[model samples]
Target: MEYAQLGRTGLKVSRLCLGTMNFGPQTTEEDSHAIMDRAHELGLNFFDTADVYGWQKGEGITENIIGRWFAKGGGRRERTVIATKLYGDMGDWPNDGRLSALNIRRAADASLRRLQTDHIDVYQAHHIDRNTPFEEFWEAMEVLRQQGKILYVGSSNFAGWHIAKAQETARRRNFLGLVSEQSPYNLLVRAPELEVIPACEDYGIGLIPWSPLFGGLLGGVLRKLDRVRSAASDLVTELERNREKIERYEAFCDELGEQPSHVALAWLLHRPAVTAPIIGPRTVEQLDGTIRALEVKLDDKALARLDEIFPGHRPAPEDYAW
Candidate 1:
């Protein structure tokens, strides 16, 4: 369990952030607690979740599950660096979602109660709110910080320009701005390498890549034909589109004597400014299996081969024009 500073902050987080999205939806409470316990035993201290993860509006089922785990004591809340998101509808009311100051305040309080914690290590906006100004966003976050409800602020699914805008606003107001960003970055989805990564780098923001394996497509999908055949239609269609590259990827993983999933995770770990890759596992075994990724070091030759298999974006102007 390698640790890295969260963005420019002194706070350290595990390189592998335990994603709790599967809790209460794909996994039961008992299983979720066991997985979290296993994560801690394995030296994992960073956990990421969202208020809307449980898929039960207003109920916050996943947070409730985690709360129970934390309630069991044993320094669970003290040791773990927990991050949760807002900007999703938690109720039917007009103030139930988005990044308005009201919703931000309400959402933070709601999450704290469900999490059974006094403060959130990192509070992120799940997506860009086109309607809300960054002014309102930072003001609300400042209040949270002053009140000791949240330690740091972050963003997710934000465009490069949006991050720039938010950062500049924070700078003017003398706020700390964003410390981390969660983006869809993987072997198949390298769009973030073009601008988002660069923007985060410029602003001292740590990149926490979600779906590091591209929704499991980069996890040796071709080797699991049986599972692919029974997978969701959309995922199957996506797999078919990238079947050739996936075949090559699995063959490369075989040559290296590593699981495709670990290889994919290792690839992200090798990239610049990536603080951690969120891994959501439904079982304790799966959580334990991911520890191998931290040890699977990719040399220059392997990285070059992966680049040839999945061509990625260069920095902006070079990628587009001259």
Candidate 2:
């Protein structure tokens, strides 16, 4: 339940963000609500979701489930910092998706209705729109801020240069720009260390890492071979590809006497740019167990060993050149 400023913003958020993408897909509505309740009990206040999460075009089933939980009251909506994204196709129409001003306005209103809330703490673009200029993006976001529909703006899956361009445009417009960037970062995926982390650090953007456990590979996958047998074929292939590294990683965690999942989460928490790592747990039990991550401290030696196992990049041209 440690709180940190979201980038340069004065707003504070929990170190672990609850991800609601599983709400209507993998988890039943009742189970999702229970997980959210457990998250709040564990002092996790930030929640991330997307309009396309339900996988049903134009049907925000997950948001509706959260809205129902908020409706039951007990200060649920008041205590949470909700972060949701757009940019996925919500319909067959051309204007139903992307970062165009029209879509931003329409999408914001729709999300507000679905979440049963007046304002979103963070409204994000799920992906960078190659066609839409940053000017258009900021202008749309500014309008949302002026109308009190969204308090902060964010980006996901953006390259380092893309973040630079976004901040430059926001600076010209005298807007807040991106307070956060959500990327696929974990112990195994160290590519962001080369550029994306540097950009976010330079621009005062909080890093919210998704898939910090590498889809459970970093979560002691070898011990759960039975479960992997039932998982998707692609997951099986991925495990085979990374089996050696995962074995080493799990061995390291065993030496520390900690669950592999907690160690992975702890690794992200130890990162300088990370504000929080999104944990998408399907059950209340899983959500409750995540609190242990806060306590597993990794010192210099442990961190050095992890880096040896998964070599990360030094910043930019320095990593490539002398």
Candidate 3:
């Protein structure tokens, strides 16, 4: 696996981050542990998880699993760089889930307790909370940094303007700004390139792309509805709207003599702005396929062909009106 600097933080992480969103619900603890072990053995040193991962009812099981793994003397804990998120609603409490100082403190303590770790490598805001002012939210994150609870801060699913606003807010307040961004980017989704990528590039922020395989739509199995249903949610509905686009992407993949997943991931890695792509797998077999994508280099011709097919255009659904 290749390694790269995580934005301006001077932290080196694996080019492919192992994401644990499926740990508790879709994947067993044993399977999740085994996957972590395998990833470590293969030189992957970065792991990503969030408090809101897993089934809707089991909101924090993914972090709990990692905590257990660490408590069990898993030497991997010290060597691996762990990243987790906050700011997702976990219950019905009105103020329980915002990025206010109170919520940040509460969430950080809970995450630290669950991960069995004193500090998180990268603490991210899962999404922008429009209800909270940028200064207010960033100030809360700064408190965590000062307390040594988190080393770096990042944002996820945020648009270019939001990122710029956060950076500006930090500058005026003399606080630590976001060092990275986590967004969905893949062959089927080039929306980030239109704005987010440029912003990150200009600001020297790292870009960590989630769903680099387009939620398995680029994993070849998505060609069939039954196979897709077994892997992801909203697949059936998504296919209904973009069936023709899916077939065309598959044909483009075939023309390049690459598996759909490989092409999808390779395309993301080919971009200069992307630091890493988070890979989530319910089983070892699934991970094996995704891991191989790092080796499938895409030349200019192939990339151009892909751009011709997908046009690097943002789908209407992915646009941020704000």
- Tens digits of per-residue lDDT for model 2, 1-322: 7999999999999999999999999999999989988888889999999888899999988988998998989999999999999999899999999999999999999999999999999999999999999999899899899999999999999999999999999999998899999999998898899899999999999999999998888888999999998998888998999888889988999999999999999999999799999999998888888889999999999999999888888989799999
lDDT of 2 at 322: 90
Better of 1 and 2 by lDDT: 1
Off by more than 4 A, model 1: none
The superposed Cα distance between candidate 1 and the true structure at residue 34, in angstroms, equals 0.6
RMSD over all Cα atoms, model 3? 3.2
- lDDT order, best first, reads 1, 2, 3
List the RMSD of every prediction in angstroms.
0.6, 0.8, 3.2
> CA lDDT of 50 in candidate 3?
89
Q: What's the TM-score of every candidate structure? A: 0.99, 0.99, 0.91
Whole-model lDDT values for every prediction: 0.95, 0.93, 0.84
Candidate 3 segments exceeding 4 Å error: 56-59, 222-226, 229-233, 313-322
The clash count for each model shown is 0, 0, 0
lDDT of 1 by residue, 229-257 (tens): 89888889998899899989999999999
Clashing pairs in 1: none
**How does candidate 1 score on lDDT?**
0.95
lDDT of 3 at 188: 68
List candidate 2 stretches off by more than 4 Å.
none
